[model samples]
Target: MANPVLLNNIDHKDLHVQTGRGAMFGDNVMSALTFPSEFRDIQACYPIVFRKADDGNFEAHALFGFQEGENLFLGMHGWEAPYVPLTIERQPFLIGTNGTELMVHVDLENPRISSSDGERVFLPHGGTTEYLERVNSTLLAIHQGLQQSRGFMAALLEYHLLESFAFDIELDDGSQYRLAGFYTINEERLSALAGAVLERLNRAGYLQPIYMVIAAMSNFRTLIERKNRVHAAQC
Candidate 1:
């Protein structure tokens, strides 16, 4: 039995609530972020993070690039953000189509204390370092095609992905699950969609392994695309 229990009623104590301009987000996208959000006032809402970084370290701003759409910038605590494009003003950041994935490097440029807490200077590293590290590792694993090497890729491709298969999430013990699927979703609609996924998934009360589902989402379009797309490269 999985210790944490992968089910509808997941405990939210650790689940990060995105507000106050904290941690950025990215999607396991090949083509583009499915259903991109319409963010109008961006030059506003500066990035805010709780983690204080140490001095003498450099940080680099990188985003998982896309070919057709705008590349969402990863800066200010890995928050996937939008800005007036450096290359094109009319066009927003282009999230590279069929991204192999991006590995944003943070060298810890400088450190300073956030207004809230003075003891800890905000360096390139903060509370997000741990989560960002994990994200980086997963992106690396996907890029290396390690799953195929491990022999789990074939079966996994079929189970958790494909929009044809929808999910219902059910939260137990009256636990509140506020769904914010990608920043683009509206208040009423985002709630509805999350409720639906949770309800469909929670019906069973538990998942044998949740990681498999995550794996499927990450590889969904890529696997299908590879199978369908005619390429010059030999199989």
Candidate 2:
């Protein structure tokens, strides 16, 4: 469970956050919830896929490993990927709503919270530090991006562009694993759409992200390679 509280300069003036990537800080996860607005950057290193949320609505995610609690991107030096999804980057912090106004909230139980070392959250005079400012921006982006994704997902469902998929992954050591319960863009359906429909998607600024998700499929090979390397080391 998370213990989230509204972040204030008075209560959190001495707070510091450990920004390094590690399983100890809860980075050992197979996937992270992502938004369409970040598909481009996420596609560069992760395979973007969709899954049904608890509310039975489709939500996007960036794949990191084949199995639960496994994150291939995490290593001794930190995350090996060129880009880290903002969802993963924003740790111990989340957006909260005070009526119609959005506010920053921090999890008190997260291991990243530190009183000494790491990035400081406030200055000596009680103003926000550069790191805290960046976190604020990240939280705002996540909030707005998720809001935008609601429309994007509705459009996909209206067009019947999402399909369930499963992958049978074979490792170099002859081990096999099944990856399932994920959804992806149906290219055949997308190609078969009428020109006017494509125009609507394009005009709505969803075409680029659609293509980005397609491009990100190529990263599965990279993910397998990382898994193979880890398997070899373990053997």
Task: Give the winner by TM-score.
Answer: 2
- On residues 1-235, what C-alpha lDDT tens digit does candidate 1 reach at each position? 1122211112212233122222122222112211001111211211110111155221111112222232223334443444421212111111222356543322121121123322221223234434334434544433343223222212222233212222222323332222121111122432344565645434532222222222223432332233232222222
- Cα distance off (Å), candidate 2, residue 132: 0.5
Q: How far is candidate 2 from the true structure (C-alpha RMSD, Å)?
A: 0.7
Runs in model 2 lying further than 4 Å from the true structure:
none
**Candidate 2 on 87-112: residue-level lDDT in tens?**
88899999989899998999989999
Model number with the top lDDT: 2
